[model samples]
Target: MSMFGAVDLSSFAPKQGSTPAEPAAGAAHNGRPGGLVVDVDAQNLREIAEGSARVPVVVVMHSSRAQASVDLVDLLERLVVEYAGSFQLARVDVDAAPEVAQALQVTAVPTVVALIAGQPVPMFQGSAPEEQLRALLDQLLEVAARNGVDGRLDLDAAAHMAEPTEPEETEVERQAREAIERGDWTAAEKVYEHAIAQSPADDDLKAARDQIRMLARMDGQDPVALLAAADAPGADLDTQLAGADAALAQGDVNACLGRALEAVRAHTGEERERARLRLLELFTIIGTTAPEVARARRQLATILY
Candidate 1:
């Protein structure tokens, strides 16, 4: 089952071959001080959710027909400005993106949900006092930190000034960048993997490989399906491994490592050794410096001796 529940959001995905409706004039801030607010629809919902991999995105679903919902939107906008880009606010007009709202199972107007690493964490429905909302937001930030989603948008830039362009890239870097842009994660990974193999000592290549691996893991499979398969009674080691990868992809580092550790404790002899090796491989993917990796290492040691 999904951490969020039995909701299958794939059904709500924008239909293929249909053009995405453009945002209304003034609905999006091109570049403003604390540019953390954006109007979202079914077409852009996936992109906004994916952005949670970098920073927590608070999605507010509301209907323009309701005055209360409009008031809630105004309040959220003010809060986003006050928060100074600590988190982004994605406003979803229910009338415009009913599919998106239905996917989230919104029973009423002005439902708030937080997306952390592409997974939804339901916040609340309807409006609350500013003080209570701030407390809830504070808690959300804490959750974001624990999941390694602690990133902030640049809030100090002036809206009137033109945004700076990125520097040009090398041939290989350009290839990888384009592949990533096109959502060809495997192709991008191959590029980085080959570069790392050619120059094993290049820390930059190694870092790039790790980052792509994480992205590939996230984009590789559906977390809910993987979890269900792993939970099956007759699930083999391979199934368990895939589930662990899915968890890691969803930014549940602890769940990923904990599942592997459970395997280590459950199996023995050759099977145990295989689990141990797989856990070590995951450690490398997560990086040696991560607190989750460190904690898993200690747990592994305890399980061994």
Candidate 2:
């Protein structure tokens, strides 16, 4: 079933074999204050569209005359900075680039579109709540990754975020990291498990243990297909649990917890207990300090009582 509801967008795909335009001279790849935000016009539309071949480009079609559009663009600019080059933001002033807007069949201001591999995907129109937009972006990344558009923008070259000093890994953590690099997931999981068992009160070790377990479960698996299977009518508990793992595998912690939470909400007796335990596993994966984990914990507490 198409999510866009009869709005055919296939025509928006870039023409086949159209050579991608090169970046301008002296471009520092997000050399502006708005991070990866770039102004798009008739002249640059092809450039921006073609650039999607490398990384997903989020096109924000807006009008300067509208305060809502202005506010949305500002919010998107901040979001681009926060995302650390997950995607490039192409700001198209519909007034200035009327031809571009008309070509894309935009009837309103503040239309948001995602271009992945030169295929235009309709996202939303008008402004959205920050949390909602964040969720959408996560979903977008997951979809893009499944379609083999897993390229990431060079965050090191981004101007928005300041570089941070990386902490030296402890010996045990280093061993576990090496094991993971070697595809010895079981060994990596065991290393963390042994460390956590020795230092029962060490929260960091416990978190690392959970992370290792998550990576082990997600190894070389299609998390998207797992999610789709779980969403199938009358899906079993095992499939639902696997879907939760898939969500975490793709970096959507909310969806990971959400799948288990939904199972808990829909089941009772032994099934609900299993679902509850699964949610607890995800909580451990993210840790208590994570905002999403905290919120999910609250939701879980509310559901239980």
Candidate 3:
């Protein structure tokens, strides 16, 4: 299965290339074999959002009062460990966070959704057997890898600390990454663009290019300044779009998408079409499977019609 559609772990693992770098000392995956699972609530939802930018957060909306939900959670608790640190889990009791349930529109007790890069991905709204759950999770890992999200969380303080290792990159990617490290956005973008032109079907190259493009847009721009300019009284469409770009560059995906949607409603004619196109571009960058993209798509259509 493609998982998040047309994307797989190709971005995460190093494709066999010309040269291989020696493994660094003390490189290891973060967290223990048990994996990192957090008990989340409405008050700490920010934790889930922030963590998703680094890795996928599996949101398990369940009711402790429901035996089925309890059983499902226990099953998941056991399952997450087997994957090591591929993805972390977050469980929210509907009884404790009814507002969270309402916001997610979760109609069932044992709903499971994934938050990837601050966007929701609806998994399912009810219980499934362990076999099915395992299959879905396997697919999720593929999606995570494809999206370049293979981060690890810190283990409990009592446990020994181990730093996560970066995946090896193709030689061309190494060149691009070196450019990025040296703060040469133009060079990095050119590297990926050239490589992509040569290997047109390489999803990894495409992802790398998108990342460099975003970085180029964000280059030398202060987030606070951009946000202030956007919030200035009667800020025009261009200013707002700039602010939205800054937001997306800073991992504020919701704000970035929201600003574009607002622009669509607040403008008319050519400007409105620009806003609509911007939203579509963002959908492409973030992956159309994102729940945020789906919601914004509906909102854009409504506004257009």
Candidate 4:
């Protein structure tokens, strides 16, 4: 069952009466950046167990002889690099820090514990996939965020993976952007419609599609004819917004604004917000100095509220 090679480490015991040791030079706390791997000798181990009474300490217990332990250390290193902001990651050699190891009752090469508010909270033990570790970190982060710990969960890092970060763009999105760039509203419409089939979570992609849909809807000569031919009847979602984009490009601000407003009526939640955002972006592109900019800002305020 061991992902790493088998090493029967069921008999290792922490030496008696050995006080926790000091961090041997580079011992980092909770994966904080630049926290170095410290030798978990007696003095460091005790310091970890009792020092730093404010921030929680995550103690990783490992055995050098165990291949699994080696692998766990490697994984911890990766987690630290990516998520050091979450917590400090420290390791203990059950072999060296016997007293402290005995105190924690660590029998395995790799055991993880989260110390929140200076109390030990158990995490994964043994080698685990990086995804699992990341998940655990996220759970802790959510708690940290709710508790307002450590300054708003590091927004920069959270934005990289948080729900608010734009979703993944689909092939539909790529095709749509291409069409728009080439000034081919017809082709743009088709690509955006296809993209909606995949419906990637990125708000920016959905916003782009909505812009195109708005444009397509307003391209005169055969307004109803175009919508009837290309856009679905009940499609007031992103694809419809793509048509609106086409309309805007054609200089039909009235129709573009109308379709965008209807999109607000038809779609709710994040999609509605995205539609509103597109219109605002349109306002900027067309020049905020214009009268329409003020109107668009009002609309954006209504939707956001």
Clashes of 3: 0
| Model 4 per-residue lDDT tens digits across residues 1-305 | 22211222122112355333343333332222123333456666555444323234457777543456778778876675566445556778664455555666554556776544334555666667877777776765554444323421232442343232466876666777787788799899677556656666645555555556545555443444444432666775766666565554433444556677667767788987887777765654444454455676676577657
Find the 10 residues in a row with the least total lDDT in model 1. Answer: 25-34
The prediction achieving the highest lDDT against the true structure is 2
TM-score of each: 0.46, 0.48, 0.46, 0.36
On residues 1-305, what C-alpha lDDT tens digit does candidate 1 reach at each position? 11232334343233456333332333233222224777787787877776665667888887543445778789988998888777888888764566687777765666888887677787877667788888888988887777666767666542433544667787779999999999998899899888888888887677666667656655646777988898899888878877787666544557888889988888899999988987887777666665667899999999999
Off by over 4 Å in 1: 1-157, 161-170, 177-187, 210-220
Worst 10 residues of 2 by lDDT: 1-10
Residue-pair clashes per candidate: 0, 0, 0, 44
Residue 297 alpha-carbon offset, candidate 4, angstroms: 81
Show pairs that collide, candidate 1. none
Residues 114-223, model 2: lDDT tens digits: 88767778888866888888887887776666554555566555554543457987899899989989999889889978887888898878767777776677666776
Which candidate number has the best TM-score?
2
Clashes of 2: 0
Per-residue lDDT tens digits for candidate 3, residues 70-166, read 8878988887677666678888876556668767766556778887665667777656888888888887766766665566654453135443466
Candidate 3: segments with Cα more than 4 A from true spot: 1-166, 199-204, 268-274
TM-score-sorted candidate list, best first = 2, 1, 3, 4
Q: State the displacement of the C-alpha of residue 292, model 4, in Å, after optimal TM-score superposition.
A: 80
